[model samples]
Target: MAIVSTSTSAFYERARAGMKDLRSQAETLQAQLGSGQKLTRSSDDPVAAARLRTLSRLESLSTIDKTNANRANADLTLADSAMSNMSNSIIRAQELATQAASTTLTHSQRAGIAEELAQIHDDLYALANSRDSSGHALFGGNNTGNAYTLDAGGNAQYIGSNTSAELPIGDGQSVTRSMTGRQLFNFTDANGNDTDVMATIKTLAAALTSGTADPAAAANDALGSLKTGLDTLSTAQTVVGTRLAWLDVVSERRTSLSELRSTEEADLGGTDIASTVAQLQQTLTVLEASQASFTKLSGLSLFDNLR
Candidate 1:
């Protein structure tokens, strides 16, 4: 009798442990169904979890790349617009210089034209010193000061850094966000002499108002310089266009890569609702059977059987 009682008690304990285990499994399946994500714990699926971590990191880096691309694009766009305006201003200067070159124009008439030229010079100076969204000089490379400033002699000079600003758009990709003042405005004339558009216009204005005996000669030289400046400006614009095109290509590639990472992450981390629900059903059925068996065992006692 003693041996039978001990055996029954051990059986009851074992049955209770099995019921608890089934309940725990049912709860886990239910939680997985609610969360819609399998392998909540690393132990559930280590390989998938590791892959998911890598994908998540890739997704984060992709977002940063996109932000850099947008900033670079915007800065380049601003530079392009400013270049167009500068080109138009240079063209107007050419027109004014052509008029001043006529021998028939009197000193007074040329002086009037010089005033307009002076205004154009100021406009070009301001345009060259344009700022970016962050209030830094857009054409000043990494320098925060104005790109073009007036010297004691009233000549426009480039005081900015020589290098253009660059932005990182990807893991190993970068692009120039802006052109330095020297790259866009300071160019060489046919005589191989370095010339800046603002200074060229200023010199023309001085010639018109100088009352030199050969004012027409100075006007002719001014016209040639203007032509050289135009050609140089066109070349710079082309460079900016090329960079913009490169940015577009980079943006497209980054977007495609981001989408691929997202797909991979979903495959690794996302749960299968149908399978989880089926598993929940099986767990609940086992748990119910275990509970019923446990209750029956609890009702049976050695004393009752002995009676």
Candidate 2:
């Protein structure tokens, strides 16, 4: 009722070995595909997978921070340029006012100077409406698309909305990216005096061109007002410089923080390829040997007949 065969025993043993090899090969292939790295995956080591995910998250956070920093830098740059142009306009007006103050200039001469001053006022309006690289007005306050428009009476008046958009640069830091004409150039001075440069230019132009012989006394009065307008422009320029300095400090800190985040990400998620490759090779060798042994043992089993 019983039969003894070395071939049968070897056949059973070989079948078991082949099954184990098949399972191992499947695992190795799965690991290779999953890791794509041939070694670093959850199946290979769960701890490494968790750490890699953490690193990835850190990297993403760093990218967001970098974006915030870039916006801050861009906004500050735009403000700086706007202030510089306004400063130049102020200086030009100062020169004209000084010339007008001189007694040697006759009525005709003062009228000519007033004509030029009108052009400068228009130019200043254009500068105040200047836009940034993003198509938003640099001086329009809060990233408005349009700048100040002249009223029916040729006064500089703003058409943009009232909201001031604040940009965030992380850690509760914020900055307003724009300023309106009303806030800067057309504001009331410490003495509650109106110093709208456009208004001053219009008034001066009308008076000088009226053919009044000895407009010298009136021109002298305008010099003080011109100085007031100059002060307003200067103050705006100073604010721009201060904002730029703050942005510079923040930008420097952001760069350093980004570097630290990069290092943390590397430590958390980076792979070690050398050890992974060695294990893959060993699994392949074992699989090949089992396949070869199974092929030879198939002939010796009773379940098989060679024709």
Estimate, for each residue in 138-242, the C-alpha lDDT of model 2 and write its tens digit: 666664576688888887777765544667766678766555666566756445786677677666666678866656665666667767777777776677677
| Tens-digit per-residue lDDT, 226-276, candidate 1 | 988888889989999999999999888888888888777767877678887
* Per-candidate TM-score against the hidden true structure: 0.90, 0.73
Least well predicted 10-residue stretch by lDDT in candidate 2: 264-273
Per-residue lDDT of 192 in model 1? 93
Rate residue 135 of model 2 by lDDT.
76
By lDDT, who's the top model here? 1
Q: After superposition, how far is residue 95 of candidate 1 from its true place, in Å?
A: 1.8
